[model samples]
Target: MTTAPVQKSSYDRYPTVPLPAGESVITGAAAWHRVRDLAYERAEDRPPLIVVDTYPGVDLPELTRQLAEAWPTAVIIDVEQEAAKPIEEIDARIADNLTDDRVFGVMSHLRLNAFYDQERLAALAERLADRTAATVLIGWGAALTATRPDALVLVDLARWEIQQRQRAGAPNWRSANGAEDNLRKYKRGFFVEWRVADRHKRDLFAKIDFLLDGNAIGHSSGVVRGPGMITGDAFRGALAAAVNAPLRVVPFFDPGVWGGHWMQDKLGLDTETPNYAWCFDCVPEENSLLLSDGDHAVEIPALDLVLTQPRGLLGAKTYARFGAEFPIRFDFLDTVGGGNLSLQVHPLTDYITDTFGMHYTQDESYYLLDADEDAVVYLGLKSGIDPDAMIADLRAAQQADHPFDTEKYVNAFPARKHDHFSIPAGTVHCSGANSMVLEISATPFIFTFKLWDWGRVGLDGVPRPVHVDHGAANIQWDRDTEWVTEHLLQGPEELSRDGDVIEERTGLHELEFIEVRRHWFENHADHDTDGTVNVLNLVEGDEVEVISPTGAFAPLRIHYAETFIIPAAVGPYRIRRTENSQSTRFATVKAYVRGTTRTDQEGPALAAGNKGVRS
Candidate 1:
């Protein structure tokens, strides 16, 4: 199943480049040096061609002009000027109803066939490549056909920055948000196509010459050279020898109807927004990792790490199964002091593929982070459930704005701190009010079919749409109260214990592609990756430090309620609790790909030793 790039070559060996101490952001002079040095190395008759890859809102023309000033002999060409068709023509090519997620989801993945001609664009690059002394093509996909450049500068920007800049009437070239028409405004509000397209761009990291972080002004937040292909022990050495510490991908926050104030108060986040509903803690698809090379901290999309070192990050067997795609995700779903999350269910694997063009289903488990006394998790259906009756009731609740007897149809369980409730595809579930949930799930993040929303409007004061039919089709009618109670209420089974360090494994369902293990300890615990990526959270600790085998990498300091990853590349590591607590014990939940299969006469068993490995 793994389609990851193979056939090892010299490209796989990346040597560590040391940077000056106490410096973090790359200055304009430094950025100029990278390009100038590359050109000097080339020593060609024709000026070295440079490609600057930037996002929609970046001031790439300004950056190109700066480069031209730095190198008097260089020529700057903004690729937008050479577009095959007018910008207006491309803007008009967008599909109608861009506000609709379903519409945008499909259109985003499709080729830009409706807008521009790739062949014509390639021809334009070919022409421009020969015209200038040092041809500098600067734009999104500007150098699509211009073979390898003497230097490639990738400027990364965050989604929030793009949206904020767009709203502020900044100079952004995104055609969808260019004009002031009703359709354009509608498109601007729900533009996530860039988020998907950016994932495709990250795969080309091996081709990048210099990575410039543009999260701040001057595009000088940091810089990093292109990473070499990662494999085996070399991968471990790179991670252990990381310039700063174990990586913590930048987290993204979004508001929802069921958002709460916990994040605002605890994390000291801005309270001006409505509330923070979800924190994308470590989702590579939308998150970025900061590689601090001592002098500057370069921010690259998290997915690039997995792509560059799939076998090293995800182990050989797991990489073979899923390729470079990181199978597990750790995120926060906060409903504390807020409304209940919409009663939702994700589609089956086949259903997701057929409906959303996604590869897999969203099988998830909610590990309660914190909850109020009355908090509850609505899961599965009650005994003697009638599918037709439930559908009719849900329809009435959405259409007529009449609330249904939710408990009468769905089973509710008291959600306490650390309670784990499995919500695999087709299993109806939702986190009720006053609860902070650490949602661990598969990579397909947004296939939720909301059947009910407690008969309330969205935070925007608009009636949220419901997918009654979609929910009905995907609902697993067989997962009644009895099945849910017996199979979904995941409890820990002791794996191994050495003195005060106890390891327990849970979530042994056959439907899961990954396994969960909790490490509770007083001092420190050593664990092996077993050739699989490990995603973990300090759910019950004040703080902890993760140390690599050689201690070359700085120990990563993780705070309470923080999530981090130990790539498969970092083979063996130790997690030590750094702060003393009243309970004298801290707990961390670790998730990874299942190395061994477990199956009985009935199916996979959830008992101790039924699956494998104690520690």
Candidate 2:
């Protein structure tokens, strides 16, 4: 069904509770007077909590003074009602802590935004969400669509109509009592609320809130949190404020509904697998993406590589791309990941058209996540095998047993952690069973170069397409294996705890969008919700929040690390270490935008007027 267009309204009367760590909650004039008078009369049992006024882009001796003043110190940062700092610098300030036992509470200037950036917002909020019930994260925000008077009336009507539905069985139940009661029940239903985010669910019943409750829900919104943040450009100011401070921060997502999937139930494609190794197409069901450890398909420089780390689940990926303009948008794909992948090479665009009817060749790389001892990759034509003999082997199925026939027909390399193989357009390759991989490749520039087969049928009861004729035609005369073996064998340095990863860069995967990193948050993993989505992955069979990438996040409960994908399209998101419960071990993937290339939209060579974009 089409979404009811959003309508804007304001709810100025709504109220929210401020943090209550002190007598004032928020040290307002009233709070300050109480403390000031206490000190004057020597009635204060505890030292006074002084509020320091600091300037924007300003560094004061406040932190040092606070620490020197007491055994335990705290900082409350507030700028003008509308203010912020660069998210990166804000993060650096908050990450500095005395110890887990010493509390670290970093708050933004107040997350008062009006748009729903599901990925960015959710990633930021999830960071504060805890798996255990010990600590609860409190978020405050508003939700609104556009502006329209009639829609506002509809919202009001809906609120009244709902109250009537649930009040049906109430002792005071009566249709005349109106629908607002039903609206209350709607909010109380854990099941329904869980179906969508708390805010979206509320929005559904908002019409009723408007109709009977006197427009309690904002047309835009008042202060609030998670999922149903106020709608429109309202959040831009809030987000900007957050990004400007040395505060805990991250991206977020609004749990709203969206649709799109590539792995359709095709005549031959089988898109089902509890395991998501092949979900390049299941945008709605399960979404994943390919992330390489380099730039521009560069030379397989190092030995080890981390491809396709896991992001949370399907929601993570979708929300990340909401409202984004991408050259090649990615999500969890639909692929036949289990079983032995066919031995194949992808035909470059040149080979596809010249040798086969297909427009492009499919030369792709698989960043394996799992594998068995028998796991082997077939890359390239055997060393010195004759073309006719190779074709003969395909006919007799002779290559099946010998596998790597002439050192050229195929090269068998056992799969291991972070291994990479550069399959030239014609080098045939297949990933064996029991292994999971993050498949990365150029756009559909070519089709695969299949050289052999297990000749197996997928869940759909269909064998994959075989491009033997084209594969044979496009096979590189002399193939290279050094880059593949070297890249896979060496690269990813099992990172050490600098305690914090200040910043660094790697190959192709330009620390673009959000750069992902993994670490522990619970066990006091010295935590704070930095306002980022933290996928809870109990790799130790324990629960924890995280934001890694790939299929790596799961299996951790079964003992594999799980990932949380935080969308970057929105304003800054944050992650807060909820309670001091489980250990917070996770990989954080930071987001960045790639520099525009000739292929990108409106890049220089394009229409002259396209030079300067988005102000």
Candidate 3:
């Protein structure tokens, strides 16, 4: 007899798994209790399993002491106070959680370490499964399976707790970014939406709803998560490994097909499709759908979290989990099926501060998601054409191509799949025609500098304004134009890498909130975290799965060529491969890396690989 297909993506089997819905936040203390309690409830008796982390933080012991007063006693094992944060600690946490070969178990407050692995949570699940064989497992935060894998009980406490606490002491925009005058407009909170049904609180469907814009799913979200908080976990075990331990992933996002509208022919440019679905705009429930907003996304860095260190390469995170002063947002885009993007420019940190009296950090880059072998992008100006020449022509109502001095202009050549040129602040650039790009940038939400818009109109069907004058002044004239064109003019190096299935151009420029790189995976790499969860992104991959510490993995097929974040705060994880067939390249951005220079020093050169690469 033929059997019916099994239903997936739900937790009906594990009725007790408390998954929150919508905007409500959940904290770590509540998360720990949920897991520990579930572990006990699922116990089958042999010397009940006792789970723990590498170095439970200050609050964990207090929580445990509180838990013990009301629950059963268990063994305590400390990995070491100073263990390397993400890598070493995660492995150890898993080993200590399992019961003896034959014993039933109740793991309490297990914390795992986290890292920047693209597939953080997947690794967490696998490790957890390996160590313990409990019938049901309890988990909290990001990256755990919906169902209990062993004696583990998990609840996604990250989103809820994060947004819940993000509103502490926000910036006095008046003084923070120097945008004193523009400070009049402030978002109460990025993801706070109206018309939300409160009863839909624990529904994953509900959460995803927040991230979609009816038709498309991207619209740039923003918020400041603040200095002390971090995303609860990356690898599943990592959360259990570093409970109360500090960690952070500057908030960023993954985009998907959603709402967007582009008016074709209006700009006098060719059109592939009149209406593009640049989905990463203003949607909601971005965490579940795994969608991200574009360069416009506002992510806050956590203060206590471990980040790449030049020591202070980025500003502290101030949004969810530890909620901060500004509004936080999450969104993404739809490249192939995405909507039209402008060929424009952004002001440098200085200009945004000087001219506009604001801080509009340089969140720029040249992203080529797809190429037809003949695609060319106008990056910079012709070698000798005066800046005023272009400006004067535009002001005199000259056609764009005329005064552009095509000879002085350098063509960004051989556009290939996944080729990215870093364009730091004060650079003149665009996303080029055809390719859809995932633009992960900084947190200030104002667009001051602009260039010719090719004469297109906004979604409302009116002509969009062009800022040629501001553009001229904003483009960094001192940058070596040749160096940028040579490396980014496009060729084989921009197409493939050793053993890489994905080809990409990265290391363009650096910023306080984000780090962009390009890579291709020949075979999926195993990235498990100790406990904190990570946002696993697939800029071009088709499928991936994150294995938890216990070996239970969550599989995803990213056919849309979008990015996804993986959160595995309780354990380790691994990303399974989708293809070994050939090359696929994509950019990897580390959000909120920390600002290299402060108000005190001259801004150091953008990290590397970015800035003024385009004309």
Q: Each candidate: what lDDT? A: 0.66, 0.29, 0.34
List pairs with backbone clashes in candidate 1.
23-295, 24-296
Candidate 1, which ten residues in sequence have the lowest lDDT sum?
8-17
TM-score of model number 3: 0.45
Highest TM-score scorer: 1
Q: Model 3 RMSD to the real structure?
A: 19.2
Candidate 3, residue 420: Cα displacement in angstroms equals 0.9
Over 499-558, each residue of candidate 2 has an lDDT whose tens digit, in order, gives 543211111222112222223332323222233222222222233332222322111111
Full-model lDDT, candidate 2 = 0.29
For each candidate in turn, give its C-alpha RMSD to the true structure in angstroms.
Answer: 8.5, 23.7, 19.2
Worst 10 residues of 2 by lDDT: 297-306
Give each model a TM-score.
0.81, 0.36, 0.45
Which structure is stronger by TM-score: 1 or 2? 1
**Model 3 lDDT tens row, 1-615:** 343333232111101111122222222245334544555665555333433221111123343353354343443222222122352443344334322221111122322223123254445445444543322221112212222322322112122123222223222211132222111212211211100111122222212111111111011223322111111222212222222211223222322122222211111112333444343321112221211122112121121121211111112332222222111222333334342344456777676666533434546454554554454555655466576665675555435444343334433444455555555566555544445444454434335354544445444354445666667767766444575565334332233445544433244453434433344564654443322223334545444443454644334333223334333232345444555323353333222233321311222344333332221
How well does candidate 2 score on lDDT at residue 19? Answer: 16
Evaluate residue 189 in candidate 2 and report its C-alpha lDDT on the 0 to 100 scale: 22
Count of residue pairs whose backbone atoms collide, per candidate: 2, 176, 186
Model 3 worst lDDT run, 10 consecutive residues: 10-19
**For model 1, how does the per-residue alpha-carbon lDDT over 404-460 read when each residue is reduced to its tens digit?**
778889998889887777777998989999999898888777567889988776654
